[model samples]
Target: MNSKKILGSILLSLAACIWGGMFVVVKIIVEEIHPIQLVFLRYLVAIVFLILFSIIKKEKWHWNTKDFRLIVWIGIIGNAVSIVAQETGTWLSSAQTGSVITSATPTFMVIFAWLILKEKLTRVKIISVVMATIGVMMIVGIHLTGKHVLEGVLSLVGAAFTWALMSVLVKKVKTYSSLQITIMSTCVAIICLLPFSLNNTTALLKINFFEPKIIFCLLYLGAISTALAFVMWNQGLTMVEASSSGLFFLLQPVIGTLLGWLLLNEDISIGFILGTLLILGSVWVSVKFAD
Candidate 1:
């Protein structure tokens, strides 16, 4: 494999790991703050860091009007819509259901990449996606019983589909630098989210921003998870096939499961071990055999 592809794989994997770790932090903070409020604050801080990073790197922000539409699609589908659907689905359904449903993202990504980008789906890629998906189902488990089963299932499925679409769309953006793409899409997402957040103004004001834990969580989510991770992911997407890069997302659940075991003292079952091994093997095979 070329160095760029290798680097892209590493960066994407690291981003996945960072995001997985954020789940633990998010679980803690969401207990005290509303998810919408947290999302608003998290992206607000993230955009600031992103802007500063762009300034430091001196990355050009210029883009044509046509590119603006691409950014808008990415912002809406990947950030605003996907997040809202995922959060709403998790609220209506169980986390296990949400995780299991969203784990279908790689499968969706492969299909979208094949259909939209005309990317070839080789046998190795297909096998890896299947193995990793089964691993994710094993790790996260699944239970669909709920009052809002249809709504939750549809929302979660939409989230996964839109997210996969966004990953594929990122490949079509050739005019903007990865950093520029991240910033524009993020700015657009924040704009899209603002109207929904306005009603929560009073609750937003009441948040204890001065609390050390809250401050830490905000910075971690904003800088490390959102800003840095998205940049890495976008850059990695540029360097590799979207379908191949999608396989790396499986690392998120593996890392999340391990973090749960270490931090929350969650019990690891035999299924967890088997799932982890399958996921790791899938990633290895996908990266090694990627065309």
Candidate 2:
């Protein structure tokens, strides 16, 4: 209802849209690059861009030593662990399975915020979460069957929980600006990922970085999706309650579905239309009434 809350919602929605569009580009590039290599390259570029931005702005990087633990937890669980789980789950299962499972992130976020941050869980918020979650299931066309059903399902569930925890944890951080938080968390994540990524150095080296399309995809992933999106998300989280922030994440799937229909010529079924309306309605309910 307040200006800051409204702005936060809009910024988070924009970040979700960028991530939604990224699904299409990632699908294309993943075929040519290993997941680890791609993720490594993305964070590497993002960190560089963030450092330069920080330098240009002359932002102070100092923080209490006690806060370092929170930063590390965020980087490890939010970035490193969640990413590995999601990628491994997708490899073991189908992308549909990954999408459907990850859609539960908002619900987990609600629960985590309630338990960890002591955020209020009103009736309207509960109903909105249920509505948005059902909409996501319908939109993603939930399919549990995959090659390694148990492993994939567990991994995806882990990813969803970790991602939710990360979002909630962002609200707990009060010592750093959004840019500083983004930079520190990303640095920690990159360090945690280095061991795994090092093994794929040969694969990374094999790719032709000079190629225009490859360069474009990498920049999009690094600059827009990683660096910019993280900053926007942290800023939004700072402005709104974590539960309210969770509602905005549903936009990712809705946007991703629409993009698929438009770009990939994917079918737009009646279920998809109905689901989209339900999700939109949930967003309205959460934003207008939940608070």
Candidate 3:
């Protein structure tokens, strides 16, 4: 109802939309690049823009040695591990599968927020999360997948859980600005990813990364998705409660699914529309009544 919460909600929604579109881009680009190397390159681009933005905004680079481990762990979980898993899973599975499976992120976030952040799950919040969960399941349907999909499914599930934990941990942080956190954590992540990316980077040198389409996708991933969306998501966390914040993530599925259908020729059913309505309802409830 208040302006700050409204702003936070908008930022969070925008971040979700950006990330949803990221799947499409990743689906395209990951065909040409390995997932780990892609993540590494994405962060390489992100850190450059982040630092420049920080400099322009005159954001304090204030940091304490004690919190270095926290930042590093958060970086590893969210930036390095989750993103690598997500891209790999998407590569192995259909784009829709990637989006739909990871839509479970909000449910994981709710649980983590309760356990780690000790944010109370109000009746309203619980109902909203439940409704969104049901909606996601409905969209996915009964026949989940066979053993063939096990690897991708596990990777995506791990991504969701780790990402959720990182979100809650980020909410616990109050001293650093989002810009500061994003820059520092991203730097740490780039270092974390370096060793893994060597072989892939060697492979990368053989490909024409400068292809027009690939370049455009890389720019979008690095600048818009990673740099802009991350700052928005993190700053939004500062404005709202961690529990309510997760509800906004439900939007990612709708956005990702629709984009996947339009761009990737992915299928959609009546369930998608019906499920999306439930998700929207849940988001509205979260914004209006969540504790």
Candidate 4:
């Protein structure tokens, strides 16, 4: 059990760190390709690599009817719906607002795990989530006032809720391997986003894929962020209780802020350090002390 938790926590933290730095990659190239189009393309690249990976590992691509639907549920809500909603929310509101609000995703995950999976809401879990969330708020600097705050906030909350629900659902599906679930759901996401990506076909042609930088960024998104990270996250979910799984997500802002400071020359204020400590401390407390 201890070994399992250690391995799961490592995988989960790695996923968070990859995603945390993903913003830097997206920031560099999102202007050339639209968000929906970029999402489609990244997953397209991801699916190919994932398929190759499955083949290499000899991962069985089989699922029963009921489990298939649940896998599809994960893909639609998690990858397709939640991502589009988050894109819309970020568009309609400030990035700062999106960061602050979407950080609530883990909190919602805690709630959903309790409601859907009947996982215990222990005092340690509650306290960890509270401390981590406050750390996020501090790092993001909660400024919710904006032109489309109401609509944006709603979309963001929906994204968080669905994502949380999807995380729990991953644990619910018992038969599929993490690789199997990731591959199947990614296929679903591609189908859902296909029409939207089609609309951006003209824009897609404008991109110079030959440019080393563009190629690198797209590959990073596809291979590192989507393929590797999703597999890690889903596999981690299978090992840990759903309630504890979300605590690892709190590592994102810490990693993101550190990267910003290191790569982007962004200033790290005193609050950033304190918040990082709190968030990291909470994750440690949860992993080390949880029964």
**Candidate that would win on TM-score:** 3
lDDT of 1 by residue, 61-105 (tens): 664888789889999999788867766665666544556677788
Clashing residue pairs, candidate 3? none
The local distance difference test score of each candidate is: 0.83, 0.81, 0.84, 0.81
**Candidate whose lDDT is highest:** 3
How far residue 227's Cα lies from its native spot in candidate 1, in Å, is 0.3
**Candidate 3 accuracy as lDDT:** 0.84
* Model 3 deviation from the true structure expressed as Cα RMSD, one decimal place: 1.6
Q: 1-291, model 2: which lDDT tens digit per residue? A: 889889998888998788776665666577677766677778899999999999999997776776678888999998778867876666666554566677788899889999999989889889998998888878878666756778988988998899899999988888898899889999998998888888867777889999898999899989998899989998999987888788787777777667766875655445787787888898888888876
Off by over 4 Å in 4: 88-98, 143-155, 262-267
Give the TM-score of each candidate.
0.92, 0.92, 0.95, 0.91
RMSD (Å) of each candidate, 1 decimal: 2.1, 2.0, 1.6, 2.2
Taking the tens digit of each residue's C-alpha lDDT, what string does model 3 give over 1-291? 889999999999899889989988998889888999989989998988999999899886565765667778889999999999999888878677887788778888888888988888788888998888778766655335655477888888888888888888888776788888888889888999999898555697876877898788888999999999999999898887887888787777778778888999877766988898898888888888864
**Residue 149 in candidate 4 has what lDDT?**
78
lDDT of 4 by residue, 1-291 (tens): 499998999999999788777655665566677778888888999999999999999976664999999989999999888876765665565444555566787899889898988888899988888988888867767556768778878987887788788999999888889999999999999999999899867898998999998899889989998999999999998887788788787777776666666775655556887887788888887877778
